[model samples]
Target: MPTLSDHEILTELDDRMQMFIRRQEMMFVATGEPHDGHDCTFVTGGPGFVRILGVNRLAWPEFDDVSLSDAIADIRRDPRISLLFVDFARGAIGLHVDGKAKVLDDDAMRRAYRALNLDPSLDLVADRRPMRWITVYVEEAFLSAAGELV
Candidate 1:
């Protein structure tokens, strides 16, 4: 298969692709580290609005969301990270994104938080505060072969 271009990646994320991602409940995020590792988190959100929360200055979401400090440090150390999404349904397509990610906590992030009703934990609390959000700047993305589907 031919490698996809930046434009192609965005096109794949159109309405249909977003639906595919949301329909599934989980995805895998592989971050760069000294030993290179993978973290799987419930996709707690849909496209255009993914979230990760924290306390103090560290951002950790559901034990899976990589710490902002760690992620940023990783980016500085190595900006190569890949996110893998697979659909369990039949004839399902798989999406793989190789990109650089950064933590975003600006006005845009605040707005995103308002639209979401998420809890790092299942229990609801009267007073809860979030830490930060990880904004993935997708660089390369594409579909995997059918054989690769699981």
Candidate 2:
């Protein structure tokens, strides 16, 4: 097998990858702080609940009554985070995003929500606007192929 350098392992998201992300309704987020262990949780929403803010940034709403404090606290102390989105039905196709994350306050959340311009009538964003948002600044993106980790 040929050796792969970091440059070869990491890549920017292309149009096809972005489309895959848009179709995902669930994602797994993993966060960790030095010497504090790591926490991973599954976040779910309707399709398109997670928005790509730019080529290198994405944001997802944080709903109330969820047990995400450990993950959020870890992010505050150490911004490093990893997100995984997979197509279970199809299998073997997924995307891994490694990045830094921050919890946005209400004002920033509102601005991000507005930027999405989703239909106000959509149940996911209508009366249930999230007060908190987690924004990730992507450092690298990788494609998971046939059970291999990139």
Candidate 3:
């Protein structure tokens, strides 16, 4: 049977949800390896960094170009990810996005975003651009009052 909490879970992000996500400058991403282990870290890219590919899709660039980051490696191997977008501006509920992810280069990532009728505005830096981008196809999303940004 479906419970009230289950009913509160949103399959697609609403306008308000989109706005909140866009306003966030940083978000925590979690990924795991195929065999074992988990990786979670914070990523930032100014406001509107996490692009909304669709109601159930999101993408962000991986800016650490020098090293093979654990999160990146896990995503490549497992593809499962969980993104937490918290509200630093207020003590509000955090938005959770659980999904499968893929890594793409600049051109490919842009194409994918365009295919969804989205504008990959790529305002990351003026001189250099990110070589890799991680796109998530969200499977589930919900808001949690537990990790409120106080």
All-Cα superposition RMSD per candidate: 7.7, 4.0, 3.7
Evaluated at residue 122, the lDDT of candidate 2 is 44
> Each model's TM-score, in the order given?
0.54, 0.82, 0.82
Q: What local lDDT score does residue 44 receive in model 3, on the 0 to 100 scale?
A: 74
RMSD of 3: 3.7
- The CA lDDT at 134 in model 3 is 86
Model 2, 12-81: lDDT tens per residue? 5666667778878999999998999999999888888778877788887776636688999999999999
Clashing pairs in 3: none
The residue ranges of model 3 lying beyond 4 angstroms of the native Cα positions read 1-7, 65-68, 115-122, 146-150
lDDT of 1 by residue, 1-150 (tens): 244543245412444444455455556667766675533333443332333231111112322244334555665566666677776564656777666666554445557556555543431222443454455655556676444322
The TM-score measured for candidate 1 stands at: 0.54
Clashes of each: 0, 0, 0
As a whole number from 0 to 100, the lDDT of residue 76 in candidate 2 is 94
Q: How many pairs of residues in model 2 come into backbone collision? A: 0
Give the backbone clash total of model 3.
0
Cα-based lDDT at residue 97, candidate 3: 84
Q: Compare the candidates by lDDT and give the number of the best one.
A: 2
